[model samples]
Target: MKKSKRKLAAIAAGTVAAPLVAIIPATSAWAHGYVSAPMSRQAQCAAGVVQCGGVKYEPQSVEGPKGQRTCSGGSRFTELNDDSKGWKVTDVGQTMTVTWTFTARHRTTNYEYYVGGRKIADISGNNQQPPQTISHQVNFGGLSGHQKVLAIWNIADTGNAFYACIDVNVK
Candidate 1:
């Protein structure tokens, strides 16, 4: 009958759309993450050490394509990378540990720390899904005075990474 044919067509359409609806959320929401300890740029914003707009509300969202080498998360959150706002320098020794906080864990690729555009530390996450908190210990060597350290968190299965710029005074 005509009703049977219409029902079959509707079932086919629903089957096709189900995969798309499920894939959309599985990719986006689980992608958010950010560094917390040692006070990253977003952490400063969230803590009111610096003034920020949307990033203060959603620190985990300051992410962009891996290897970009800058913050702001690709313009939607440019305030994440803004330096004129002035951040409080965290007092750090020659070696310090930085931590990342995530609501949903993902298989991590690696963690990179850069000072003055030079890579000072690289830690492997080994495609392991860490706990809610991830930490990396970095050595700044003889570097002193005020400096900005850019930290990148690359995800294993995705080409995206979360970026955080930490201001520190190496002591």
Candidate 2:
């Protein structure tokens, strides 16, 4: 009878621990933000505008180490790095408003924008938590034609940053 009790206790412990084991990894990988306007690569994936992998389920989760240049933020969402992924290109003038939609607002260092591997704009975040929606007017300068814009949100308290890639046609 003691052996049966021990077996039942083990089963109960396993049942209780299984869910926590599953939930722990997911909690660590929870992400916060993404570019909403201009339809970032992950945003497109989430909207079903493009078929994608895991990123489609969480467009705002493309979080990785900062200062990396890839749209995926060098994370597992490598689909964002595919240049031929048939992303819709939005046409805009010399300047356009880039908007970010945040699910969880973290204290931010700054927002950076890059085009053709060149830093085009850097908007200071003042190391403060942002609103649910934030917008920046990014000037393309002399850049024109088809271009891929990389947007990065550097978190003040972490080494990770959220990344988004926007395909656009500058007129």
Candidate 3:
């Protein structure tokens, strides 16, 4: 009789404590916080399919202030708003890669790549090729060891293009 009561109590305690135990670790991991990249400058093309797009480095990090933000750190606030094509940035800690893809319909367009506001690679005039991919790996160049990279794209033309951005941590 006494054993039965004790067993029931133990079961009830386990059921209540198990959930609490699981939740604590999850909450801690969630609170670790996230960081974001700097910034990239972008603009539409004036003549050809491609235009000048520079990288902008925000000298300071952005504190959350108060509320939680979907993005954190000094990420890129500049972007290339073109519905035709796609632009993406992949940050691999040591090296950051930015990729731009466009269709032949977007010929005469130009794209400029930069690291820390310094022009790194400039691709001009689409070769009138079919939908393709163009990518460049940028060396942050004596950065602060590990840099949160930000990439920007400028759709200088009105044609069609696909764009995406990704961040990869090498360390």
lDDT of each: 0.85, 0.93, 0.36
In model 3, which runs have C-alpha deviations exceeding 4 angstroms?
A: 1-94, 101-105, 125-130, 146-171
In model 3, the Cα lDDT at residue 119 comes to 52
Cα RMSD to native, each candidate? 2.9, 3.7, 18.0
Best by lDDT: 2
Residue 168's lDDT within candidate 1 is 90
Report the CA-based lDDT of candidate 1 relative to the real structure: 0.85
- Which pairs of residues have clashing backbones in candidate 2? none
Q: What would the TM-score be for candidate 2 when compared with the true structure?
A: 0.84
Give lDDT tens digits, candidate 2, residues 3-71. 999999999999999999999976754549999999999999999999899999999899999989999
lDDT of 3 by residue, 86-156 (tens): 32323355555554433222333444433334555555545443245455665645553332233333233
- Model 3 has an lDDT value of 0.36
Candidate 1: worst-modelled 10 consecutive residues by lDDT: 25-34
| Candidate 2 lDDT score at position 86 | 92
Following a full C-alpha superposition, what root-mean-square deviation does model 3 have from the true structure? 18.0
What is the alpha-carbon RMSD of candidate 2 to the true structure? Answer: 3.7
